[model samples]
Target: MKIHNPFRTALVATLGVGLGILMITSIQTLSTVILYIGTALFLSLGLDPVVTMLERRGLPRWAAVLITILAVLSIFAAVVLIVLPVLIEQISELVDQITPLVQNGEQTIESLKGWMTETFPNLAVDDVFAYVTDWMAKEDWQNNVAGWTETIGQGVLVIGGAVLAGLFGAFIVLVLTIYLTASTPSLKRSAYQLVPASKRERFIDIADQITDSVGHYVMGQVSLGVINGILSAIFLSIINAPFTAVLAVIAFFFSLIPLVGTLTGSTIIVLACLLPGVGSPATALAAAIYYLIYMQVEAYFLAPRIMSRAVSVPGAVVVIAALSGGALLGLLGALIAIPVAASILIIYRQVLIPRMDQR
Candidate 1:
């Protein structure tokens, strides 16, 4: 052990550093592809339970996997087809409405100034509005606001090369998901071969539990999102809300974030009703009432039933995991955070706790 040469040790350390640098650079360069691969893997794990259920119900594994993929794609297609047209129309309508909205805002500000002048004669609050009104009335201000408003996040929606690249990335993810899901058994077999012989059976059991937990969590989240979207769509349509489909689609994404997401999803709808001076203030009030009732229904009834089958994490842990993951990796990070926390808890309980008890 003491026969190490200084030159040899130095060369090895230098090579290790060089290799690490190379790996980091390569990962950065191919980050997009890597992200797609990770997404596909996540989807595969999430959907694996459904595939297994189908297999247990007498369908062949391949047939089960195919059916699951088809079901997923069908849902995706339906969302796109149903929501895309409405979203486009809503964007156009929103742009057209902006000028009137701005004008209404100016009127509201003037009205507020008048009210302040009457009620608070001693206060200089009215002067604040006067100064703001003068600044907002400038031609440059109007054009600048209007110019950005007209564009309306249009760059991302445009059918350009950038959009096509996004489509390509999606296609890759979709293909990988299907392939990986179908080959799950093979992957498991190969993975088991890598485990130490004595622990292989135990490892498989733990792995299965983890995978099942992941699957349950994913399905539960998706179920919650779909329910939120459908309910939102129905309510918005019933109320004749401005962008029913667009808001519903938005709800679907927001609902994927746990707990606070419902509030956020509904807040956007409420703000659209209230802030867009084109609409009645009552619409916003109605939105707030509806969401309050719905949040209660979700917390006491829906979430309990839906999330029960998934690995349970403490409420405090859930919030911390979501925040930490979100800070690190944005939406995807937040989405996976709870399940990851659950897995850690599982390992601690089954592995660490037992070992500690024995000691």
Candidate 2:
């Protein structure tokens, strides 16, 4: 005959609730730290293929890691050095050309008004202009700004803090990536040791395949981005497009997105081409045509060759993963989405389906 202690149970429940609350609070507070750690781990995985390639060529592990890091950093440095000055100069040139661009816009507007007046004698351009002007006056954005000064000030502070945090996060990720990359073998061994002896071999094999896929995905995406940027620069320069360097850089980053990246990037470039001082509708049309042809080439030829080593995710899976990830974590989510889908798919095919079949 045992008596249940009500007081003791209540106290235990209280303690458990308190502990859960503490854990939630602690996790919220350390969100940024977790973000950095995850970034570092992903970067290490992404860089592993390069490291392994060098290692296979008889380079020591340390030497392989160092070479891989150096090559990546060197290319980044070169891009910054070449693109920065050109970007700045292009920006300044845009600023300098703005007055002309505005004048050209006004002239076009005037010509359109004249044509409309000639075509429709009763059409009142003055009334239309007055209505637009009145609508603009009604908005009074200055009053909104005045009312939200404190909110705006807080926003500015938040932006500044975010920028500082970004820099710190980058540093943390770099250090962690270097350490993890160099120590991966030992880390894997230690991690595997935690698994049951019977399952360890299977776990290792699956993990190896998944990580290899991750590495291949990263390399393939990077190669495609470089190709996209270079091609954009060539085409934009040929058309004498304004802000070619900046547009190319934009294309480079946008090309990281799967499926629709090239189309999105091309749209942006075409719009820039349609700018008053930049390019005309004819040039924009030509640019669109060029990208259409390029997109087919990339899809049918370039992607297959570059991504041969990576596990293929279906188009629907790629799209859903990218959208879901982007909705959750923006760039990082989108960047990792495909690889995540690939990993899940690998598990499904190798583990889940086989087990189901066995059952």
- Error at 70, model 1, angstroms: 1.3
What are the per-residue Cα lDDT tens digits for candidate 1 across 1-359? Answer: 68469899989999999999999999999988878887888889999989999999999998999999999889889878978888999888888767664578768666656666665689898678668768878746866877787676676467576789978988999899998999988999999999999999888988888888888899999999999899988997887777777888888899998876788888988888754334556777887799899989988999889988778888899889999988977888888888889889888888889999999
The prediction achieving the highest lDDT against the true structure is: 2
Instruction: Report the lDDT tens digits of candidate 2 across residue range 110-161.
Output: 7657766765689998788778769867987557767688899999999999
Off by over 4 Å in 2: 1-3, 99-134, 141-161
Query: Against the correct fold, how does model 1 do in TM-score?
Result: 0.85
| C-alpha lDDT of residue 315 in model 2 | 95
- The residue pairs found clashing in candidate 2 are none
State residue 283's C-alpha deviation in candidate 1, in Å.
Answer: 1.5
**What's the residue-level lDDT of 200 in candidate 1?**
91
Model 1's lDDT to the true fold? 0.84
* lDDT of all predictions: 0.84, 0.87
List per-candidate RMSD values in Å.
4.2, 3.9
